[model samples]
Target: MRFTLFISAILLLGCTPKDTIAIERQLILSADFSHYDNFFPIQTLNLIKKGIKDKIHIMYVCFDPGIDGEKEFPGEDYMDDFSFKIMKDGKYQPTFDKSALVIGNDFKEYFKEDFDSYKKLKAEGNISRFIEMPEKPEWWQYDQTPKNSKGKPMTFICQIDMGRIIINDDCRLFVFYDQDDRMVKYVYQRT
Candidate 1:
Protein backbone atom coordinates (compact mmCIF):
# COMPACT_ATOMS: atom_id res chain seq x y z
CA MET A 1 0.00 0.00 0.00
CA ARG A 2 2.77 2.43 0.90
CA PHE A 3 4.79 1.67 -2.22
CA THR A 4 1.71 2.16 -4.35
CA LEU A 5 1.06 5.55 -2.77
CA PHE A 6 4.65 6.59 -3.30
CA ILE A 7 4.49 5.82 -6.98
CA SER A 8 1.19 7.58 -7.24
CA ALA A 9 2.63 10.66 -5.58
CA ILE A 10 5.51 10.74 -8.01
CA LEU A 11 3.18 10.51 -10.96
CA LEU A 12 0.91 13.16 -9.54
CA LEU A 13 3.82 15.51 -9.18
CA GLY A 14 4.34 15.63 -12.92
CA CYS A 15 0.64 16.13 -13.50
CA THR A 16 0.41 19.30 -11.42
CA PRO A 17 -1.21 22.26 -13.13
CA LYS A 18 1.09 24.42 -15.18
CA ASP A 19 0.05 27.61 -13.38
CA THR A 20 0.50 26.11 -9.98
CA ILE A 21 3.43 27.30 -7.86
CA ALA A 22 2.66 25.00 -5.01
CA ILE A 23 4.39 22.00 -6.50
CA GLU A 24 7.59 23.85 -7.23
CA ARG A 25 7.54 25.50 -3.84
CA GLN A 26 7.10 22.15 -2.18
CA LEU A 27 9.87 20.55 -4.22
CA ILE A 28 12.48 23.23 -3.54
CA LEU A 29 11.68 23.71 0.12
CA SER A 30 11.56 20.00 0.70
CA ALA A 31 15.08 19.59 -0.63
CA ASP A 32 17.72 19.21 2.07
CA PHE A 33 20.99 19.86 0.24
CA SER A 34 22.81 19.57 3.53
CA HIS A 35 21.81 15.94 3.77
CA TYR A 36 23.45 15.23 0.43
CA ASP A 37 26.40 17.50 1.15
CA ASN A 38 27.14 15.93 4.48
CA PHE A 39 28.01 12.66 2.80
CA PHE A 40 29.17 13.90 -0.61
CA PRO A 41 31.37 17.00 -0.49
CA ILE A 42 34.45 17.29 -2.71
CA GLN A 43 36.80 15.09 -0.73
CA THR A 44 34.26 12.31 -0.52
CA LEU A 45 32.22 12.78 -3.72
CA ASN A 46 34.23 10.09 -5.47
CA LEU A 47 33.49 7.65 -2.72
CA ILE A 48 29.85 8.64 -2.76
CA LYS A 49 29.84 8.37 -6.53
CA LYS A 50 31.36 4.92 -6.37
CA GLY A 51 29.16 3.73 -3.52
CA ILE A 52 25.90 5.47 -4.25
CA LYS A 53 24.66 5.44 -7.78
CA ASP A 54 22.01 8.12 -7.38
CA LYS A 55 21.12 10.86 -4.92
CA ILE A 56 18.55 12.94 -6.74
CA HIS A 57 16.62 13.20 -9.97
CA ILE A 58 14.62 15.78 -11.94
CA MET A 59 12.35 15.60 -14.93
CA TYR A 60 12.53 18.14 -17.75
CA VAL A 61 11.33 18.14 -21.32
CA CYS A 62 14.48 19.74 -22.72
CA PHE A 63 17.43 21.71 -21.48
CA ASP A 64 18.77 24.67 -23.42
CA PRO A 65 22.38 24.75 -24.68
CA GLY A 66 25.02 24.49 -21.94
CA ILE A 67 28.53 23.24 -21.14
CA ASP A 68 29.45 19.62 -21.43
CA GLY A 69 32.18 17.15 -20.32
CA GLU A 70 34.47 17.34 -17.26
CA LYS A 71 36.23 20.65 -16.51
CA GLU A 72 39.30 19.60 -14.56
CA PHE A 73 40.89 21.70 -11.81
CA PRO A 74 44.68 21.20 -11.89
CA GLY A 75 45.04 18.63 -9.10
CA GLU A 76 41.82 16.69 -9.71
CA ASP A 77 38.69 16.21 -11.80
CA TYR A 78 36.25 16.87 -8.99
CA MET A 79 34.22 19.64 -10.59
CA ASP A 80 31.67 18.30 -13.05
CA ASP A 81 29.12 20.16 -15.16
CA PHE A 82 25.71 18.59 -15.78
CA SER A 83 23.46 21.11 -17.47
CA PHE A 84 20.09 20.16 -18.93
CA LYS A 85 16.48 21.33 -19.10
CA ILE A 86 12.95 20.11 -18.73
CA MET A 87 9.92 21.21 -20.73
CA LYS A 88 6.61 21.42 -19.01
CA ASP A 89 3.46 22.74 -20.63
CA GLY A 90 2.81 25.59 -18.24
CA LYS A 91 1.81 29.19 -18.71
CA TYR A 92 3.89 30.33 -15.75
CA GLN A 93 7.26 28.69 -15.85
CA PRO A 94 10.10 29.34 -13.43
CA THR A 95 13.87 29.11 -13.70
CA PHE A 96 16.25 27.80 -11.05
CA ASP A 97 19.55 29.60 -11.47
CA LYS A 98 21.64 27.19 -9.41
CA SER A 99 24.94 27.30 -11.29
CA ALA A 100 26.79 28.49 -8.20
CA LEU A 101 27.16 25.29 -6.24
CA VAL A 102 30.58 23.91 -5.28
CA ILE A 103 31.10 20.37 -4.25
CA GLY A 104 33.94 18.46 -2.48
CA ASN A 105 36.74 19.69 -0.24
CA ASP A 106 37.38 22.94 -2.11
CA PHE A 107 33.77 23.85 -1.49
CA LYS A 108 33.75 22.93 2.19
CA GLU A 109 34.42 26.50 3.22
CA TYR A 110 31.97 27.83 0.72
CA PHE A 111 29.30 25.52 1.98
CA LYS A 112 30.20 26.54 5.49
CA GLU A 113 29.64 30.14 4.53
CA ASP A 114 26.38 29.32 2.83
CA PHE A 115 25.30 27.26 5.80
CA ASP A 116 26.04 30.18 8.05
CA SER A 117 24.03 32.45 5.81
CA TYR A 118 21.25 29.95 5.71
CA LYS A 119 21.15 29.86 9.47
CA LYS A 120 20.86 33.62 9.60
CA LEU A 121 18.17 33.61 6.97
CA LYS A 122 16.25 30.94 8.78
CA ALA A 123 16.50 32.80 12.04
CA GLU A 124 15.31 36.04 10.51
CA GLY A 125 12.38 34.43 8.67
CA ASN A 126 13.79 35.85 5.46
CA ILE A 127 14.78 32.51 3.92
CA SER A 128 12.42 33.32 1.09
CA ARG A 129 14.56 36.18 -0.17
CA PHE A 130 17.36 34.26 -1.91
CA ILE A 131 19.12 30.95 -2.16
CA GLU A 132 22.59 30.66 -0.66
CA MET A 133 25.89 29.55 -2.20
CA PRO A 134 29.32 28.39 -1.05
CA GLU A 135 31.64 31.25 -0.17
CA LYS A 136 34.59 32.93 -1.97
CA PRO A 137 34.57 31.02 -5.25
CA GLU A 138 34.19 34.39 -6.99
CA TRP A 139 37.80 34.17 -8.15
CA TRP A 140 36.83 31.37 -10.48
CA GLN A 141 33.90 33.41 -11.78
CA TYR A 142 36.38 36.05 -12.94
CA ASP A 143 38.31 33.63 -15.13
CA GLN A 144 36.17 34.30 -18.20
CA THR A 145 32.65 34.12 -19.49
CA PRO A 146 31.58 30.52 -19.80
CA LYS A 147 35.07 29.33 -18.82
CA ASN A 148 36.69 27.30 -16.07
CA SER A 149 40.12 27.18 -14.37
CA LYS A 150 41.88 25.95 -17.53
CA GLY A 151 40.98 29.13 -19.46
CA LYS A 152 38.96 27.02 -21.87
CA PRO A 153 35.68 28.57 -22.97
CA MET A 154 32.72 26.65 -21.53
CA THR A 155 29.95 26.17 -24.05
CA PHE A 156 27.56 24.50 -21.70
CA ILE A 157 24.28 26.25 -20.83
CA CYS A 158 25.13 26.51 -17.14
CA GLN A 159 26.97 29.24 -15.24
CA ILE A 160 26.92 30.79 -11.81
CA ASP A 161 23.83 32.94 -11.52
CA MET A 162 24.50 34.08 -8.00
CA GLY A 163 27.01 33.46 -5.23
CA ARG A 164 30.19 31.32 -5.46
CA ILE A 165 31.44 28.18 -3.77
CA ILE A 166 34.84 27.83 -2.13
CA ILE A 167 35.83 24.59 -0.50
CA ASN A 168 39.33 24.86 0.91
CA ASP A 169 42.16 27.23 0.00
CA ASP A 170 42.83 25.36 -3.22
CA CYS A 171 39.46 23.97 -4.29
CA ARG A 172 36.33 25.67 -5.59
CA LEU A 173 33.05 24.83 -7.29
CA PHE A 174 30.17 26.69 -8.99
CA VAL A 175 26.41 26.21 -9.28
CA PHE A 176 23.77 26.90 -11.97
CA TYR A 177 20.11 26.12 -11.87
CA ASP A 178 17.17 27.52 -13.85
CA GLN A 179 14.25 29.20 -12.12
CA ASP A 180 11.90 26.83 -13.82
CA ASP A 181 13.87 24.17 -12.05
CA ARG A 182 14.29 22.96 -15.59
CA MET A 183 18.04 22.77 -15.31
CA VAL A 184 19.38 21.83 -11.90
CA LYS A 185 23.08 22.30 -12.63
CA TYR A 186 25.56 21.55 -9.88
CA VAL A 187 29.34 21.97 -10.32
CA TYR A 188 31.42 20.69 -7.48
CA GLN A 189 35.17 20.42 -6.90
CA ARG A 190 36.02 16.86 -6.08
CA THR A 191 39.16 16.32 -4.09
Candidate 2:
Protein backbone atom coordinates (compact mmCIF):
# COMPACT_ATOMS: atom_id res chain seq x y z
CA MET A 1 0.00 0.00 0.00
CA ARG A 2 2.89 2.42 0.83
CA PHE A 3 4.61 1.76 -2.53
CA THR A 4 1.33 2.34 -4.41
CA LEU A 5 0.75 5.67 -2.61
CA PHE A 6 4.32 6.85 -3.40
CA ILE A 7 3.90 5.90 -7.05
CA SER A 8 0.55 7.70 -7.21
CA ALA A 9 2.09 10.85 -5.72
CA ILE A 10 4.95 10.77 -8.27
CA LEU A 11 2.46 10.36 -11.11
CA LEU A 12 0.37 13.31 -9.87
CA LEU A 13 3.46 15.51 -9.66
CA GLY A 14 4.56 14.49 -13.15
CA CYS A 15 1.11 15.22 -14.55
CA THR A 16 1.16 18.81 -13.25
CA PRO A 17 2.00 21.36 -15.91
CA LYS A 18 5.28 23.22 -15.64
CA ASP A 19 5.30 27.01 -15.46
CA THR A 20 6.70 28.64 -18.58
CA ILE A 21 7.46 32.20 -19.60
CA ALA A 22 7.11 33.63 -23.08
CA ILE A 23 10.50 34.78 -24.34
CA GLU A 24 10.42 38.20 -25.97
CA ARG A 25 12.21 38.55 -29.28
CA GLN A 26 14.24 41.49 -30.49
CA LEU A 27 13.05 43.41 -33.60
CA ILE A 28 15.00 42.96 -36.82
CA LEU A 29 15.50 45.47 -39.64
CA SER A 30 16.36 44.26 -43.15
CA ALA A 31 17.42 46.39 -46.11
CA ASP A 32 15.92 45.11 -49.35
CA PHE A 33 14.64 47.09 -52.40
CA SER A 34 14.59 44.58 -55.21
CA HIS A 35 10.81 44.89 -55.23
CA TYR A 36 10.68 48.49 -56.52
CA ASP A 37 12.28 48.35 -59.96
CA ASN A 38 9.72 50.60 -61.65
CA PHE A 39 9.82 53.53 -59.21
CA PHE A 40 13.64 53.74 -58.95
CA PRO A 41 14.31 54.23 -62.65
CA ILE A 42 12.09 57.30 -62.95
CA GLN A 43 12.65 58.61 -59.43
CA THR A 44 16.39 58.27 -59.89
CA LEU A 45 16.22 60.96 -62.55
CA ASN A 46 14.09 63.20 -60.35
CA LEU A 47 16.60 62.71 -57.51
CA ILE A 48 19.45 63.63 -59.86
CA LYS A 49 17.57 66.73 -60.88
CA LYS A 50 17.34 67.53 -57.17
CA GLY A 51 21.19 67.15 -57.08
CA ILE A 52 21.69 63.52 -56.06
CA LYS A 53 24.32 62.27 -58.54
CA ASP A 54 25.18 58.77 -57.33
CA LYS A 55 23.25 55.52 -57.17
CA ILE A 56 20.47 56.08 -54.62
CA HIS A 57 20.84 53.88 -51.58
CA ILE A 58 17.62 51.88 -51.22
CA MET A 59 17.25 49.98 -47.95
CA TYR A 60 14.32 47.88 -46.66
CA VAL A 61 14.36 47.72 -42.88
CA CYS A 62 11.47 45.91 -41.12
CA PHE A 63 11.19 45.88 -37.34
CA ASP A 64 9.59 42.81 -35.79
CA PRO A 65 8.46 43.71 -32.24
CA GLY A 66 8.15 40.11 -31.02
CA ILE A 67 5.46 40.32 -28.35
CA ASP A 68 2.54 41.27 -30.58
CA GLY A 69 3.94 39.71 -33.73
CA GLU A 70 0.75 40.23 -35.68
CA LYS A 71 1.06 44.01 -35.73
CA GLU A 72 2.38 45.80 -38.85
CA PHE A 73 4.83 48.66 -38.33
CA PRO A 74 5.40 51.06 -41.18
CA GLY A 75 9.11 51.78 -41.77
CA GLU A 76 8.41 55.30 -43.05
CA ASP A 77 7.19 56.33 -39.59
CA TYR A 78 9.68 54.19 -37.67
CA MET A 79 12.74 56.35 -38.35
CA ASP A 80 13.53 57.52 -34.83
CA ASP A 81 17.29 57.97 -35.27
CA PHE A 82 19.13 57.29 -38.51
CA SER A 83 22.30 58.17 -40.38
CA PHE A 84 22.25 59.50 -43.93
CA LYS A 85 25.08 58.92 -46.40
CA ILE A 86 25.89 59.39 -50.04
CA MET A 87 28.14 57.49 -52.44
CA LYS A 88 30.64 59.90 -53.99
CA ASP A 89 32.94 58.59 -56.72
CA GLY A 90 33.68 55.09 -55.39
CA LYS A 91 33.31 55.55 -51.63
CA TYR A 92 30.54 56.09 -49.11
CA GLN A 93 30.48 59.67 -47.89
CA PRO A 94 28.82 60.61 -44.61
CA THR A 95 26.47 63.54 -44.92
CA PHE A 96 26.28 66.66 -42.76
CA ASP A 97 22.59 67.05 -43.69
CA LYS A 98 21.59 65.53 -40.37
CA SER A 99 20.48 68.97 -39.22
CA ALA A 100 18.26 69.21 -42.27
CA LEU A 101 16.33 66.08 -41.33
CA VAL A 102 13.28 67.03 -39.34
CA ILE A 103 10.64 64.99 -37.50
CA GLY A 104 7.09 66.06 -38.53
CA ASN A 105 4.57 64.15 -36.49
CA ASP A 106 2.21 67.09 -36.17
CA PHE A 107 2.25 67.62 -39.90
CA LYS A 108 1.59 63.97 -40.60
CA GLU A 109 -1.17 63.81 -38.04
CA TYR A 110 -2.67 66.99 -39.44
CA PHE A 111 -2.46 65.62 -42.94
CA LYS A 112 -4.11 62.42 -41.80
CA GLU A 113 -6.95 64.39 -40.25
CA ASP A 114 -8.21 65.48 -43.66
CA PHE A 115 -8.76 62.06 -45.11
CA ASP A 116 -10.76 63.38 -48.06
CA SER A 117 -8.17 66.00 -48.96
CA TYR A 118 -5.35 63.56 -48.44
CA LYS A 119 -7.04 61.13 -50.79
CA LYS A 120 -7.62 63.86 -53.34
CA LEU A 121 -4.03 65.04 -53.23
CA LYS A 122 -2.81 61.48 -53.42
CA ALA A 123 -5.00 60.86 -56.43
CA GLU A 124 -3.71 63.99 -58.11
CA GLY A 125 -0.16 62.71 -57.57
CA ASN A 126 0.64 65.81 -55.52
CA ILE A 127 0.51 64.23 -52.05
CA SER A 128 4.10 65.01 -51.23
CA ARG A 129 4.20 67.41 -48.32
CA PHE A 130 7.51 68.91 -47.12
CA ILE A 131 7.17 68.37 -43.40
CA GLU A 132 9.25 66.80 -40.67
CA MET A 133 9.22 63.04 -40.30
CA PRO A 134 7.53 61.66 -37.20
CA GLU A 135 9.82 61.58 -34.14
CA LYS A 136 8.53 58.18 -33.07
CA PRO A 137 6.95 55.35 -34.99
CA GLU A 138 3.13 55.36 -34.91
CA TRP A 139 2.17 51.90 -33.76
CA TRP A 140 -1.53 52.63 -34.36
CA GLN A 141 -0.87 52.93 -38.08
CA TYR A 142 1.00 49.63 -38.05
CA ASP A 143 0.36 48.90 -41.71
CA GLN A 144 3.20 47.10 -43.47
CA THR A 145 4.59 43.80 -44.63
CA PRO A 146 5.26 41.36 -41.84
CA LYS A 147 8.59 39.56 -41.58
CA ASN A 148 9.94 36.72 -39.53
CA SER A 149 13.08 36.67 -37.40
CA LYS A 150 14.99 35.28 -40.38
CA GLY A 151 14.00 38.36 -42.42
CA LYS A 152 11.66 36.36 -44.62
CA PRO A 153 8.33 37.87 -45.75
CA MET A 154 5.61 36.30 -43.70
CA THR A 155 2.41 38.24 -44.44
CA PHE A 156 1.23 41.72 -45.30
CA ILE A 157 -0.94 43.62 -42.86
CA CYS A 158 -1.96 46.37 -45.24
CA GLN A 159 -1.41 47.23 -48.87
CA ILE A 160 1.68 49.44 -49.32
CA ASP A 161 1.25 52.57 -51.38
CA MET A 162 3.73 54.06 -53.85
CA GLY A 163 6.63 56.08 -52.49
CA ARG A 164 5.88 59.80 -52.05
CA ILE A 165 8.54 62.51 -52.43
CA ILE A 166 8.05 65.19 -49.79
CA ILE A 167 9.83 68.09 -51.42
CA ASN A 168 11.83 70.35 -49.09
CA ASP A 169 11.77 73.09 -51.70
CA ASP A 170 15.19 73.45 -53.38
CA CYS A 171 17.00 71.80 -50.50
CA ARG A 172 15.84 68.15 -50.64
CA LEU A 173 12.84 65.90 -50.29
CA PHE A 174 12.94 62.40 -48.91
CA VAL A 175 10.76 59.82 -50.67
CA PHE A 176 8.72 58.15 -47.94
CA TYR A 177 6.51 55.95 -50.06
CA ASP A 178 6.08 55.67 -53.81
CA GLN A 179 2.55 55.14 -55.11
CA ASP A 180 1.69 52.70 -52.28
CA ASP A 181 5.00 51.08 -51.49
CA ARG A 182 7.18 51.79 -48.45
CA MET A 183 10.98 51.65 -48.52
CA VAL A 184 12.87 50.09 -45.68
CA LYS A 185 15.80 52.47 -46.04
CA TYR A 186 16.72 55.41 -48.25
CA VAL A 187 19.91 57.56 -48.26
CA TYR A 188 21.01 60.43 -50.48
CA GLN A 189 23.06 63.64 -50.42
CA ARG A 190 22.01 67.27 -50.87
CA THR A 191 24.07 68.97 -53.51
Q: Model 1, 1-191: lDDT tens per residue?
A: 74565345334322212212212223332233222332222110111222322122221111112322133222222234334332342122222322223345544565566555434544554222222222223435344223343544432221222232222223233443333343334453322
Predicted structure 2: clash tally: 21
What's the lDDT for all of these models? 0.30, 0.26
RMSD of each predicted structure: 16.5, 23.1
Best by TM-score: 1
Residue-by-residue lDDT tens digits, candidate 2, 1-191: 74565345334322211211111111111122223111111111113332323323322122112222222223332232122233223122222222222224444442333333334544564232212223222232333333333565432111112233322211122323221122222322233
Off by over 4 Å in 1: 1-34, 38-107, 130-191
